[model samples]
Target: MKPKELTRAIVQAFIIIVLLIGLYQVVLSIQSVLSYILIAAVVSLVGRPIAQLLKRIKFGNTLSSVTTIAILMTTFFGIVSLLLPVIFEQAKNLSLLNVNAFEATATKLMNELSIYLLDYGVDLQSWVDRSLAEVDYSFLPDTINTVLNGLSGFTIGVFSVIFISFFFLRDSGLLERMVMVFVADKNIKRVEKSIFSIKNLLSRYFIGLLVQITVLFIVYTLVLLIFGIPNAVTIALVCALLNIIPFLGPIIGTVLIVFLTMTSNLDASFASVTLPKTIYVLIGFTIGQLIDNFLTQPYVFSTSVKSHPLEIFIIILVGGLLFGPLGMIIAVPLYTALKVIFKEFYAHNKIVKALTKNI
Candidate 1:
């Protein structure tokens, strides 16, 4: 190529690269805004059915949207209010905790475990000592401070999400219109169909998740109460919330419940009271999980989302690998959306056709 032509091409490429880099930096700077938008979109999708129901009863568009938002806010704050007192009480208990007593209790338990495991040649004491030596408690104060500092941002984000969700609910097609701006005229209709399908499927999927959490919460609370665990309701809520993360969530929730249960009555005799109670609580948790796996999950995954169980498992694993817990939480909905889009644009592809057949 001529020198001048080569020079011009290099300049053009440099400008394009510079523009892309600037866009990336801008996106990074505005990431919080993007998060608010994504969250608001989910909120709107979840509330869409309520808004539609209100509209069917002759409510004005604005009135339906306002009422839906009010209902959602009330429910959210109601749960928060119920949880806050328990949380504060727990925090106060932590602040006033007798560290030496806790340590002694832990040591006693470890000793008993070591005695039981001695026959198997497992030296838990040495392992525990090494683990304790490596532990870092210095992050506690900094973590607390960070949480306190982030409160203001969290408040702003909540308000922003509510504001955006109201508009989204009031104008059901607003997101579609925004998306249409970037689509070619020829593809606009296909994109519209895809959006509509995604909205419906995702709305049901999210609602199904809410139902699943509610069921699990009820079961967990009953079990905890039956076992007379301290802060049973709060602990149950936390565990139930964790179940939103698919396969890994239940295991984490079980471990958390067991830990909390054991710690709650540390003064009691381990062999007689603590161990038996922990075992009972663990059994209850297993029952709750059985109900969830056999009943709640099938309806949610097969009926609401219309995805195969194996497909979901693989996607969630991949998502967890790529982006951790948040990815697992969102993987199904994102996958559902992509499948819809692909089916619209690539109906002839065998894999796309197979994946999207249920939709």
Candidate 2:
């Protein structure tokens, strides 16, 4: 290469490296604020359609933004209000169990399993018992207090999210203008198109999230009711909400439902049964999960993110491997955003072309 060309190449490389380093430092410094910002952005995305509807009706942008936020807050607090009673009742019932039926069920199951496993030379029951014996069971109070203390911070973050999102929604052109300031004039239109695509996709994704949760909650509740579980509504609501977290969340929620079912009798109004209704609970969960896996997930993924189910599966698996549960939860929306951007800016790149062809 000519000396002049080599010097220019080196300068460009140095500039790119420095920019990357500065970006990393800024991200690190604003990590806490970044979360709130992301939350606000999502809020803005979800509220966009409503804001647009109001705008079409001749409502001012600021008024529509506040109204949308008000609706969102009301729905959030309404659900929280409903959950608190169920939680309090669960705690009360647990405290009242002097000789818990759940413990009896566990001991009985273990004894039977121990006898069955003895033939295989694998003592699963004893191992479980030993593990349980080692658990502390004492820090629970301190943990509760710590969570209570953190409520203030959580409240602050909530307010921050609402505050930022209001501005985001009120000024629909604000984000576009802000992004354009950093874009070259030649690429500004492309960036604007990409931003529009992202907003539309994310809006559908989050709105579909609410629809998914509601459908699952109702289905789960009805299934549990058929099995004679007294706290069907509570369990179903929690499990449905947890489905928002993706794969791990559903599994954890199902396990929790099973445990709760194992503690209580199937007959809420009749004579108390000695044994836990494990079999019925298992059946209900199996059917409920099948409905979730086969029905709800396909519709939501296909319609919301506009991606194939298999593609979403691969992305989520990669996310889980790279960053665990949190990564898996965010995998779809994050991938969709990146794909949009890449389609706009790197359309010539073969891999980007392949990945974004469907989008």
Candidate 3:
């Protein structure tokens, strides 16, 4: 290739890379605003049907939205009020446990394991020592405190979401008309179809989530109570809420539940040691999650959004890397929107149609 052509191509690639990096930085900077928009979308999708139901019951659209918001607000506050004290107490005890005993035990175990591995010629001691040297053991307390401080902000966001959802629920007609006018003017059928697909996907996903959350809450409460765990009700409620986040949710929930159960009984505090307790927790979570993945979401959201597990995982990882926990939460819905748009493009593309015919 000519030097001028090659130089032009090189400059183009450089410009693209710089632009992408700048775009990513901007995304991260405005992530909190993006998070609120995502939360509002999900809430609006979930509450739309209820608002319609209220309208059918003779309420005006504004009144219906108000009623729906009121129900959600009441339910949320009621659950929070009941569970707050127990959760706070458990969190305090868990923190104290970490400082007083757990950290020492963990350090001792690591040292013993390192020694054992060195005897076996594994050379694991150096790795362990390096890792320990780099870690800030004191960071846990600060992390927990930071998360606790953020709860008030989270609550305020919840209110913001509800307020935004009200506009969506009450003024949906105007919004639809505006969208239709814009799309019709541009003659963009694909965009229209993609939007509808995303709306349906989000609506179905939220409904499935509600059903799964309710079932899991019941199951968790019963199982924990049967296992003689203290504060089972509060723990179960917390677990249900946490489980809304997908994969990592269960790990955090399990750790918190197990820690609470351990402290609830000095005798059965053999949580980390007892085979029965560990197995029970594993088996219960496995069954519950299996039911949710296989039955609930599939049946409810089958027509809405369909993507492979690997794709979903990638989206989640990217989202979290860009936006943290909130990104992880909205990854599925965003992916669903992408999937719908791509599918429509595939369906209409002449090349794709020819390839399908050949296959």
Per-model lDDT: 0.87, 0.80, 0.73
TM-scores for all candidates?
0.81, 0.81, 0.73
Question: What ranges in model 3 sit over 4 Å off?
Answer: 1-19, 88-145, 173-184, 231-233, 267-279, 290-304, 345-359
Candidate 2 per-residue C-alpha lDDT over 1-359 given as tens digits, one digit per residue, 9 for 90 to 100: 99999999999999999999999788667755866777787788788888989889998988999999998899888877776866676677667765656566557777887899999998887798899999999999999999987898789999999998999999877767877999998988888899989988887888778888888888888877877776788788888888877788888887887666754542231123423355666667777678877887888888888888899899999878755665677788889999999998899999888777767
Query: How many steric clashes between backbone atoms does each model show?
Result: 0, 0, 0
lDDT of 3 by residue, 186-305 (tens): 547777777877777777677767777888888788778777677878888888889877677888888877666665543333436433665676567667777767776555444445
Best by lDDT: 1
- Tell me the spans in candidate 2 whose CA falls farther than 4 Å from its real position: 1-25, 53-59, 100-109, 132-153, 263-276, 317-326
State how far residue 48 of model 3 sits from its true place (Å).
0.9
Ranking by TM-score: 2, 1, 3
TM-score of 3: 0.73
lDDT of 3 at 21: 96
Q: Per-prediction RMSD in angstroms? A: 4.6, 3.9, 5.5
lDDT of 2 at 342: 90
lDDT winner, 2 or 3: 2
